[model samples]
Target: MTETARPAYKRVLLKISGEALMGDQGYGLHPPTVQRIAKEIKIVQAMGVEICMVIGGGNIFRGLAGSAQGMERTTADYMGMLATVMNALAMQSALEGVGVFTRVISAIRMDEVAEPYIRRRAVRHLEKGRVCIFAAGTGNPYFTTDTAATLRASEMSCQAIFMGKNGVDGVYDKDPKTNPDAKRYDAVSFDEVLRKNLRVMDASAIALARDNKLPIIVFSLDEPGGFRGILSGQGTYTTVSG
Candidate 1:
């Protein structure tokens, strides 16, 4: 990475699944993996790109999983939201450890731990070069963190949303893990993704992004320097747009 190699985007929202923070662990956050990802964000920040992050809670508690086990739907979903808050704090600590300024803003307020999500406040933080970690998944049950990411991206007027996946590099024609012959797309239209029921994001989230003309860059977080490489236009990733 060179100082003169400018990025195509000035600001972006990074959507990372809770599973991405788990590394090889079956559940919960892995300190080393979280630190590595924080370094990736720090590198991007050094490039002068403003960032907003939304992390999922599947590593700690998945709403659907809880519901499947007979827990009340709303109750399970709230548990998932709390899990995201925990992940956000962990990420905040890691990013701060590397000297990157961050603000953990939550949709569901717990004033003692995280600041409440206020659009104007978050924008101000970005203006000052601080990464805003949006947590608690819209503060509503049923909506995934993907929707929260899209919502925050739009609210923040981000150039795009960078979705860092754990295993797969990009959107595939089939499950790459299950099918060796699966093909990955370099770029795909939002409608194509929805029509094919691809797993880029949930239908509501995709539709929200499509309606707002927000592009989503899906890439592998497991690859070293992958996030920074993609921003510099040097990596393999899928761009989902209109």
Candidate 2:
């Protein structure tokens, strides 16, 4: 393989917001976009890398948003968890459509639709070259999907967590969409992300990754071939480490 086609990781966990699946729509899954992401995952898997995925449910429901509108926090959070399961199923269909084997594992017990989250089974699925999509936000309230992604990545022993974003390509000092002068970092330390309050991931997730010494690569999901390109060491992205 050429240098540009060589992937840098043996295994990784991809974390994306449900908003990423919505495309230009205000909310809900956009089938074309979902298929596009699945194809990206397929490219990486073709390179022989184990894959785990965690997709946020912000497009369909957000517990914090529900709470802000006067719903009970825990109930809203559980509702949000269910939303993630929906997203997971959508992604599973897309991945399967592309001929990439996938498993939708839920943290909540919903055996009819998805398999319950079991670390060993999930790891075994990855070992067998199937993509594992973790859903249901750690099966608890008060914790964001970011935390769930970090927790799952740690448990799966992923080499890195790829934070697939929409719009902007990498972590910036300011909101790039709002500020034309926003500067994107080539690399940033986890401490700097916390001290600067940069929006790489949640504080808890960042802390967990830092504690475990796992690197995070922040990149745009909208860029065609972007995820695979990054793994091949040929993309514009910010690496968070040390």
Candidate 3:
């Protein structure tokens, strides 16, 4: 087999699960976790790659968690969305602390805190090498940040979506945590993922990616410097495309 190093993508969407922001305590934002993530991103930024980010709110509140406890679905979802905004702000501050230019754009408008989500403005930010942090989960209930990642990727014309996962490296035939013998796939088609009910992202997010012909790369976020390694084609990851 001929081996050739993969080229760095010109622009990319980075989807970070909220659980990643939770450190050893297993709750809320961990400053060190955010700082480490930001540092990895700084390495990629220095490589001349444009980036856009979407951070989930699982660390603070997940709609499913709230709904399962008897809360109204819409209210729970909104709270979950707000939680993502909080995560975005935390990330923005961390990135800026390292001298990386970043802008937090929210699906829900809060003029005092962040810019309202506008596809044009976001694209402009990326073109200028300014990282854009998308928050608030599409500004609508019943939508996960996974879906928002796909939307932003398409909107910004990103070459691929990088899913920064915690613990597990990639999608598996079964829950890796529960089944130690679960088979891991290095590469797979989106259709196969849906056919087998893989829990990488929700169906809506997967469908959007498939429709747009965007490749999704899943990798470990907990690994120090893993984000930069993925961009440099030296990290463990799974690619889903075509």
Candidate 3 local accuracy as lDDT?
Answer: 0.91
* Error at 75, model 2, angstroms: 0.5
How many backbone clashes are present in model 1? 0
Query: By descending TM-score, how would the candidates be arranged?
Result: 1, 2, 3
Which lDDT tens digits does candidate 1 get at residues 1-242?
68778988999999999999999989999999999999999999999899999999999999989999999999999999999999999999999999999999999979999999989999999999999999999999989999989999999999999999988899999999999999999999999999999999999999999999999999999999999999888988999999
lDDT of 2 by residue, 1-242 (tens): 35336679998999999999999998999999999999989988998889999999999999999999999999999999999999999999999999999999999999999999889999999999999999998999999999999999999999999999998899999998989999999999999999999998889999999999999999999999898888888889999999
Worst lDDT 10-window in candidate 2: 1-10
TM-score of each: 0.99, 0.98, 0.96
Worst 10 residues of 1 by lDDT: 1-10
Task: Mark the regions of model 3 whose C-alpha exceeds 4 Å error after superposition.
Answer: 1-7
- Candidate number with greatest TM-score: 1
What count of clashes does model 3 give? 0
Find the candidate with the highest lDDT and give its number.
Answer: 1
Q: Put down candidate 3 lDDT per residue, 115-169, tens digits, no spaces.
A: 9998888889988889999999899999989999999899899999999888988
Question: What is the lDDT of every predicted structure here?
Answer: 0.95, 0.94, 0.91
Count of steric clashes across candidates, in order: 0, 0, 0
